[model samples]
Target: MKSPRVLLCVRQNTLRWDGEPSSLCCSSCCVLRCFDDRAAAARVNQHAHGRGTRTSLVRHGDPRVRLIAAHRSPLTALFSARGLQQITRQQQSPATQRRMRQQVSSEPQGVAEDILHLSAWLARQPHLPPVDDLLLDRFLYNCKYSLSRCKSVLDMYYTVRTAVPEFFKHRDATEDSIRRSCEVTLAAALPRLTPAGHRVFVHRLLDADSRRFDLLAHSRRVFMLVDVLLHTEPVLGAVVVLDLHASTWAHVLRAPPPLLRRLAVCFQDSCPIAIKEIHFVNAPGFIRKFLDIIRPLLKKKLNERVHVHTGGLETVGKSLPLHMLPKEYGGEEKSLKELSDAWQLALERRRDWFKAEELKRVDESLRPGAAPERAQLFGVEGSFQRLAVD
Candidate 1:
């Protein structure tokens, strides 16, 4: 017995899993170049085996290799749902995953190559608008630099802005409603990143009067901050710290299904932001009711990421980056108001960018086929729909 074979998640669409072409790997990696070509498969088998033969098995255990019970052999089994995705992260442990995200790629060559490839692809698409290299890099980073996924998302990214005008339009920071929403609700991007390179976003009501709440406007303001982040921040992902301590039943009632649908579309679908986790701190008595309305709107995977806590921030501190949080929530940073004001100033400074971006949207008429229909995208009940933004 020489040695145990190993399972490799081959990179790109040009070759089968773990072959010579594109030897680099992915967690959600690999696809067969041609399932019908026996010659090609045999060549891959020969290339991997020392004696130029088709091997029946790879190693039984690799933390990177996540397996399922399949009728097919191991070679073909890698083609299962989990193995075929473009984004990796098969069966990695929590600590391992955290370390992976925390480790920023020091090598700029790979990123530079990815940007060039992505930029070329972007140029070929007639319907898509011109995207800056920085924005393209952001998309590439979020997709784990998967060119295929990045291209697919870039299409939807512009399409969503055109489709969901309610959330995307009128994003001017100085406007009275937008400013008023900022005053009543603190939807500020925190100054610090979690140990895993995820930016912390705080959402809460500064005003107890539920009557003052404008869910859409409040949400628009929140989105404005995120727009600033997508272009400026280079974090691996985001961890949302939603403090509902000051909320009431009236606030809960303000979240109607339609508004929730559009809002969900904006957060979950449009932009290329990876939400690592969502922690609801100081959850209220009616948190269940609120979840009941919103949970169904979210994707199954996203629904699993939602966590609710009735206790104080201390409970959340166990998981979230409490040390980086503002003093109001138990941390070393400045108070929440000061942070909110700073973000407000930041948004105001970019006032012209928001104005200019309003002009950019998919000219559906120029699209190759029929424009994406509202009914087809989201049901009649929803003004916006969730795309594969994550």
Candidate 2:
């Protein structure tokens, strides 16, 4: 006795519905069609036996016939007509192509290619730590994509991290003291951007108590914020708004000159982001004395960008958009207290990630390049000029 035959439809790009061959035009197209009826099987066999049509006959006991009715994979459908048309328009538009090319060219030359080349270059040199694509990209960006400049900055960045143990070492955000300092410092990156596309970062001394203000902890918090921005925000530069309104003389006195100098050098030389401007708002009279102490340490260009405004919020408004500032600065935005509370919660959420970063550091002995001479790189020790106390 012969086994019963099953009729199956195998038309290309055609659908099947209700045991009938159907075109894709139908809104309810079935992906697969199979028939076990003897009459339907006999009809399909007669027409498709020698016509080379997609119809196929299978024995009733064949396991393969049972699998024929399964739905077709959605991945087989590449794109819709509308999607293809949109892609065609984008490719045809000269203005769109030109704008895209310009944006790509603005980045370091061969950004993707350089990542591979730099990785290989670092591997050949002894004593260098393994280079990751993300870190290399940051170095390239900070150096304006110049390969040589990128290499130089990379060296300096790790060197500074190793040299300044006070600022970078043992910086676990989970510790009680460090967490308390982060809350008191109230350093945060604002959601708003400057008119020129620079991200706005505001730092204020929320706690006037000198005991709570640890310069090292404050530096760690600032670096943590910078790390967050580097990965998340896409901006050309940064505008730092330093609100010294609540800062007291005790806080200033606790910030030693040497520590301040190290912080300045790290930002000026090692950091991979451009500091567009540093707005010192609500500054005190004695602030100038402190500024005078560090003025010589700063590069001439950076010093020019530093604006000291003592005329209250009105003076700061002249340089920045008042509408973007917090309510304390006469802006319509959220109050400083509200922003600070929200930021504190954000930091708490990332505590574990920050802790992991604290354990990772560069081994100076492994550097194939010349080790950074701390005295020559930072400056002569005890050479800092004393500031006038009166």
Candidate 3:
């Protein structure tokens, strides 16, 4: 095994950093060297943390130049981590940027540095799409600031997006069928977080007529609500409410197996939303039968988190704030009609944003493999069941 080498390329004789002393270089204010002890890499990364700083530190074996930068070497892949920070600032307003900076500053040391490193790693992956730091920051928080888990989640996220195109693509909210799905199921992220600081999302069956339902359209609308919720709300996790008051067999039987399999794939592993608890209320006898049929398909951890209420909203009310819930569910909040309408309007306003996100799916053709592994993901039948139970 060879020692890790750090190579630096500078454009000046003296290097300066904010609140730090200058270090002298050589040969027209430029210096390039590869070392074995790896002492220089730590200092290089420390200086690279300064704003608007430019320095190339590449690791190679046996003291060789392994693509430091365009100036010193042929590889231009080594980008300043400042690029990621600039993206975060450009996307947010002055107020939001300041807020984010303050939040990061309050965290333990090296949090921001790890986020920048995560963004840099994503940049090097040829198959992945670009993501803003805001989203990455939330994902880091979701993973408890663990870089390895964050990377795995992001990888599955984009890969699953490609494999499950039906839910992710064509997310325009103005379509008639999509619009109907919204009205049929009163779905929205409740305005108030639970006592534990988890966002509360509720789904109720408004239109009892099962014949009017389209599984695909309903699934798409549900995910749309979820996407907007996770992006806008800040919470420790999420608590899902499924109120199945008037659902019938017609609605349950209409869901196809393939679609259920895809939904399971995205919801189970692809999504970054951490579901704290799932509560079922106003459930009927047949609903249990449906759950029994699909029970074997769910993961054990998820199955353990599920709760079927035998009483009223009191059980759910204990989990969520009463004043923030819909009045129908025994809370002091607005009625489901009011909350759903507000969310529907919000979704309409974000139609353009959702359309833009549809283009973020991975291009499997360009993936560096003989063939993408997507076919095997959805190829098995009866391996998945629908959590989209109305």
Model 1 ranges with Cα > 4 A deviation: 1-107, 382-390
Pairs clashing within candidate 2: 127-366, 127-367
For candidate 3, write residues 239-337 as lDDT tens digits. Answer: 888887867777788876566667766777667777778888887777787777655656788889888875555566566656666787677777777
Tell me which of candidates 2 and 3 scores higher on TM-score: 3
Worst 10 residues of 2 by lDDT: 83-92
Q: Write the per-residue lDDT of candidate 2 for residues 301-372, one digit (tens) a residue.
A: 889988888755446654467876777777766766676555555555566766766555567677655555
Q: Which pairs clash in the backbone of model 3? A: 12-29, 13-29
TM-score of each: 0.71, 0.67, 0.69
TM-score of 2: 0.67
Candidate 1, residues 1-390, lDDT tens digits: the string is 212212334332222234232444654332222222343344445445633333452332332222221111113223312222111113234564457555544233466567778878767666778886657766776767777777777888788788878778998889899888877888766665565656678887777899888888877788877777666534467788788888999987887887777666656666678787888888988889888888888888889989998876557754555666678767877777887877777778778889998888887787766677765556565444434422
Candidate 2: clashing residue pairs, number: 2
Candidate 3 overall lDDT versus native: 0.60
